[model samples]
Target: MKHLRELTSLPTTGLYAAIGTFDGVHTGHQQLIQAMVNQAQKTSTECAVITFFPIPAIVIRNIQTPITLTSPEEKAALFEKLGLNYTITLQFTKEMAQLTPTEFIDLLVSNLPIKQIWVGEDFTFGHQRRGNTTVLSQLGMQYGFETIIVKHFLQNSEKISSSQIRNWLTSGDLESANKALGRPYSITGVVKHGDQRGSKIGFPTANLAVWEGKLLPASGVYATFAQVEGKIYTSVTNIGFRPTFVDNEPNAQVECYIHNFDRNIYDLPVQLFLVSRIRAEKRFESISALIQQIKNDAAKSEEILKHAEFQTGLLTGSTKTAP
Candidate 1:
């Protein structure tokens, strides 16, 4: 998909546009995007997604939220997967934030033949967040464009939202969160050099230092899957400071020990999909103690993988251990 960084540089074409931070691109966001696609197809217009860079939460909070479910690059990839024609990532600025509702719309819609706008039911925009669905619908009539608002998606009578998904992730409920997201939540990062303590203990792991502003799940040992070079492997990941080893370290870290896999993958990018939490991070008093704990962790991970394999109906012709 074409990424237009500046709204002013957007070409003049009648486009059906969906707007949101689309952080997780959860089920609710998908509904809106699908609606936009259908509307664009019916109207014979280009389908486009208008999202923001440096999401408002990151800019406003000034705290790096853990490992994101998807990075900006991943979000773009998803847009392509969803069959969008163009993706616009607006560089949000303080000046843009100050624009009145009408001014914001005028600036965004200017020089572009926008035939329709799609947003979620609770969508809001403009200065001090004054723009709401009511204002958007009113402006659509005034501007001679159509507006579509998708109702919030409900699961078990509760609204499925990014925040709720975040809550699920924080609570280590990956299955439920994945169900709400319509896909697995993943964290992408490059392998980094660690203390090599795991290797010394016969469980070599690839340390993954997450990107800035990425939202990470709670600190725990989790059954996970890792994707590397387009291949998926079941693994166990530890998401926390190595409390058993480095009790004084302040920052938490993500380290994954891929089961039945051994390859020189240092610096290679990998995506980790959490499947389930096995246990909370804890401090072990001795190296032997930690090693024993890791063995047990690996055993639990193997059991979880076997069950997952059965559930997914993955055929394993042979147990070829990775080297």
Candidate 2:
């Protein structure tokens, strides 16, 4: 898919467009995107997604903590997999947030000949959150475009949403979060050098340097698939401070022990797709106790991975024990 960073760079040809913050690009967001793609294909018109970065909420609410489900790069990859023709990432700024509903629509309408605009029922936009599906249709008429509203994708009688998924992660509800996401929630980072404490303890782990603003699941041990150097490994990951080894850690540390594998992977990029939570992280009474717990976690992770469904194309690498 062709990705453009600015509205000015959009093509002049008429297109089917899906617009939203789409932070997680979760299953709810997928419905609207897929509908646009399907219609665009049937009509032989190009389709594009106009999404905002830093998400409007972080800018408008001045949220300081990391709350994103997927990074911009990851979201673009998902859109491409959904068969989008173009992906437009608009930088969210205070100035852009102040635009009136008409002004915002004008900017989009002028840049691209949008034939139809697809959005979820809960979608809204413009200054002070005044725009809604109703406003969109009114504006669509004036701009000579059709507004298509896709129903919410729901689970357990509740609409699936990014915020709800974040809540699930915070509460250590990996299964529900994964269900709404339509896949396991994942984090990508570069493996970095550490104190080799895991190595000393005989359970060597690759320390990951994750983005400061990336949202992480609750502190615990998890069953995960670690993608490294084009190979997938069944792994057990720990996402918390090593309370037994360190004092006063400023941030959570992510480290994973790739089962049945050993190699020098420092500085290499790794993506951890969390399948399920194994246990909560706690300080063991002794190093030996910690070693015993890790062994148990590894066995449990292997069993969980045996039947877990992996996202397609992500398993292009070896699904068995990575060398």
Candidate 3:
């Protein structure tokens, strides 16, 4: 897929495009993208995906509650996995927000080969979200294009949405969140050097420098995987303020202790995949008590992974792409 940042000029005229923030690229997004791709193939047009960076909320009001499910690079990768021909990353800015419904459509029509457009039923755009499907459809008629409003994809009578996934994550309901996402709820971050407390205790952990404003699940010990050096290691992750040391830290930290592994990954990047929440974080009476709990957590994490039919989302190798 061609990842584009700036709109230059029209390359071709017959393109089928789906436009959205597509944070999680969750099941709902998968359904919509599938529809777009199917329509594009049937109409002999190129498939395109138009998304934004920093999101609209952050760009407009500076309200950053939207815990991004995927970064810009990761979003493009997912779109590529879905076999889209073109992926455009529009920068959401104040100027872009000022466009009226007609003007927005005109801009896309003028710049992109947008023969057909796909949006969700609840999709709103143009100047404080004044444009709705009705306006979009009218513009489609005026501009000689097609407007398709895909209904909200539901799972078990609940709407599958990125917001819902965020709520699930905050609640530590990994199963429900993963169900909505069609994959494990995970976090990717660069390893940051922390107090070498874990290593000193023979349980060296790779501290993750998670993106600011990204929502983390509840404070707990979880069965997870440490994806480092392109290898998946079964590990126990503690997401909490380390109470055993009695520090002044209030923010919850993600610390992954890979079993029987010792390597210096202070500045390396790692992806931590949460398989299940093992137990809530607690303050042990002493260092020995905390160490014993860590050992038990490691053992439990290994057991959970050992019996799995496959590691979380093809840890060894992934051969599948989007449907």
Give the candidate number with the greatest TM-score: 2
**Global lDDT scores for all candidate models:** 0.79, 0.88, 0.82
Model 2 scores a C-alpha lDDT of: 0.88
Give the per-residue lDDT digits (tens) of candidate 1, residues 1-323.
Answer: 78777775455467888988998887777778877888677877788898887776665555464535656777777787677988888877777778888997887677567888899999999888999999998998888788888898898899988788889888878778877887666788899998998898899999987886677887888887787887778788999888777758787789999987889898899888776789988988888988898889888987886666311111223232233
- lDDT order, best first, reads 2, 3, 1
Preferred candidate (lDDT higher): 2 or 3: 2
What lDDT would candidate 1 get against the real structure? Answer: 0.79
Q: After superposition, how far is residue 265 of candidate 1 from its true place, in Å?
A: 1.2
- Provide the TM-score for each candidate, comma-separated: 0.90, 0.96, 0.91
TM-score of 3: 0.91
- In candidate 3, the residue pairs with backbone N, CA or C atoms under 3 Å apart (3 or more residues apart, or in different chains) clash, namely none
In model 1, state the lDDT of residue 23: 81
Clashes of each: 9, 0, 0
Which regions of candidate 1 fall more than 4 Å away from where they truly are? 8-12, 61-68, 309-323
Per-residue error (Å), model 3, residue 177? 0.6
